[model samples]
Target: MIIEKGYDLRESLGVLWKNKNAAAIATGLVATLFSTMGPGLIVMNAAKSGGLTDAQAISWLLGIYLIGGLSTMFMSLRYRIPVVTAFSIPGAVMLAKILPNFAFSEAIGAYIVVAVVTLVLTLTGVMKKLVERIPVPVMLGMVGGVLLSFATSMFTAAINMPQIYGVMIAAFFLSMAFKGFSKKVPPIVVAIIIGIAALGFFNLITPIPLSLEIAKPVLALPTFSLRAILDISIPLFFLVIGVQNIQAVGVLMAAGYKVPINAMYVVPAIGTFINSLFGAHPAVTAGPSTAICASPAAGEKKEFRFIAAFSEGVFWVTFALLAKIIVDSVKMVPKEFTAVLAGLAMFEVFRSAFEGAFAGKFRMGALVAFFIAVTNLSILNIGAPLWAIFLGLLTSFIVERADFRADKIENSEAIEAAK
Candidate 1:
């Protein structure tokens, strides 16, 4: 039995090593680093607007990435899934709006409150039930809506920097066209190499000074206020639960994984709660990154593909430890190049989401939800995703009622004729 167990372990490791190729590594890096670009900027801007000193702002960001890395590493290993976790982007955007109004302590307090509320929801199974209740089409529509801008950004990048972005775009297409010829090659990886080469050739890539500096955690005691709770905490909780977590689960399902919804929610909730004490934003399952990790390009076998996520976790931890180096390296790359890369990386997700959302009985309702989500309409300070679900369901109920009535009438007529 011992020998057999050892053999099994060796076989698993062999599969993991064999499958962990350049494409998987590049995917993990892109998912971990590129996905955080927008949110990291938001956090910095929010910290600055909230009257934090330069040091405090840096500390806030460091804390977030550190905790985020640790949490993702732990959860991915624990579940043997590519469960990537990060600070919420919509939540960060919402924070940037509200954090300016409150003192830094109060903002920390609000973060704690949001985390606590998330934990409560998870423990009570409220979060799981809420996710299950949302129609799959509507959920897909919401995911598509949220990601639409990122997809469109590729064109925007080309318009902004045609020479650089054009090359990147060409690389993407060429890689895709030839992907069938080599199972080991991932198109995104090819794109990244081409992008870097172009940057170097154009003298556009500048080497930033980097050093091995570990980020220190910044702890702040909570100072809760009713206004802060209402403005920051509640909205953040809703955004994380309704937007981020829902999207994460959708991505997993679309990738053909049987997601442990309850465990997924609980793990992130606990991570967020713990991280809040150290001045980190709420950590939740990351959508775009998770999608990348769960993609078939990660590995040929579904069972062993988890190594892709594990590799991502390892990258996150490395980035956190060498935060300066990683961030500086990423910054050295042209913005347009990064944008092109992100858009290409997320193209598959967009395609899958659009197909799933519209190819169903609730097409019209799904369309309504898709439009609302894409517009990013917020009502009563709530995010658009929640409103999309509500309005979509309402539309489905009202419009589909006629179909129900018609079926009933047809059944009655057949019965009368038989009699």
Candidate 2:
């Protein structure tokens, strides 16, 4: 016998568009993008500074953003957790230094190698052991240090344009006030509205210069060679493996979820492989980027974060497909206005990173981690995150071992007294 049944796609669809889901997903998307845009913009500028032409830089930016967003969607679904990732800021920094002397194709070759090594570690579970050994203090410190530069830039911009900074500060407080009075309304969104209005009121915003359109994407194939691997891959690996992965894992744990390291590594690594083919850099897990997906406003439902991530990919891809229009639209805003928002958005992340490191009993350990991260040392080609972890664990181990010995001696004395 055959059975026929009727189903309502609208039922499932309605749940997603309901007041709760709509508010949650909307808030999550806004927070994630706003917080991340600072770093994304910085990475774009870094690419330009590194000698990439406008076309090349935008191609890398949009490609990585799209690939990374989609990768997060898959991982979030598989893990049932909000695990968002992005291109490593440290890797980008390394690129800024190396790209001047080397060809872009050579850089792409290096990115591919990093992704391969990351995949092997994840598939073999070797990366999990390395992740487990990381001390919390070190992770916190590494995050704090990496984000420090951006935070400083906000106030620096305020100095450059006092009026814009003044408005931003007002917007920050207004956002806080709104969040307090109404739990549903997100402060960042409100702040953004106010910021834009302020810019408009003061006549500071630039008018549209030309019609906006999405620029064409330039796709390329990988050219792997021994020289390319040596020049690009090794350094890129040190930066991504050492810093970006550590901070992303820490952010997840801090938000009260402990995802398996393999999920974190493999998903983004695969995305990076895809990105490399398109002449984009390797993407890694984003700490602040995930915070948006993990926000309370994203929804009480378990899948809200994943849903939010899924939606973000949709929006970003849409924006990417209209790259020229999006770029042109952004051009209409004064450069200083973008700078102000970028700095303001990162404030929360910077605060949390420092707080996590120094606000506990492990303040001493956190301090050690901070110094190591800020120093930005390299050992055998490995970078600061790994170094911070090494120092933090070393400190913790010594302190614990000393306590263990002391306990043993005290127990022996007590046993003798009983005898």
| Top candidate when judged by lDDT against the true structure | 1
lDDT of 1 by residue, 1-419 (tens): 10011124355556667666766666576676555544555565456447666446556667667767776666555555666877776565445445666777887888888777877777776765555444556556765776677667788887777677877787778767875632345666677777788789889997878766776656777898877776667656765776677777767766666566766676677777776776667888887778878887775666655677767777766655654444446667766665576567666656766886788556677788778877765567655665666677688778865533453455345334422
Best by TM-score: 2
The sequence of per-residue lDDT tens digits that candidate 2 reaches over residues 1-419 is 01112124344345445533585557556744563455555555456556776666667767777777677655655555666767775456445444665667767777888888988877776775555443444456655665565566667877877676766766676767765543444455555677677778888788876655565667756667666675467545644665567667655666666455666777778888888876788888876667667766677765555567556655556545554454455566766565566556556656766776677544566677677766665566555655665676577566645533453465345334422
TM-score of 1: 0.67
In model 1, state the lDDT of residue 239. Answer: 58
Against the reference, the lDDT scores of all candidates come to: 0.66, 0.62
Which pairs in model 1 have colliding backbones? none
TM-score of each: 0.67, 0.71
Model 2, 91: alpha-carbon shift in Å? Answer: 5.5
Q: List candidate 1 stretches off by more than 4 Å.
A: 1-65, 76-113, 180-186, 218-260, 277-280, 286-311, 330-334, 373-390, 400-419
Off by over 4 Å in 2: 1-24, 35-37, 76-81, 89-106, 180-212, 220-261, 289-291, 303-305, 329-336, 360-419
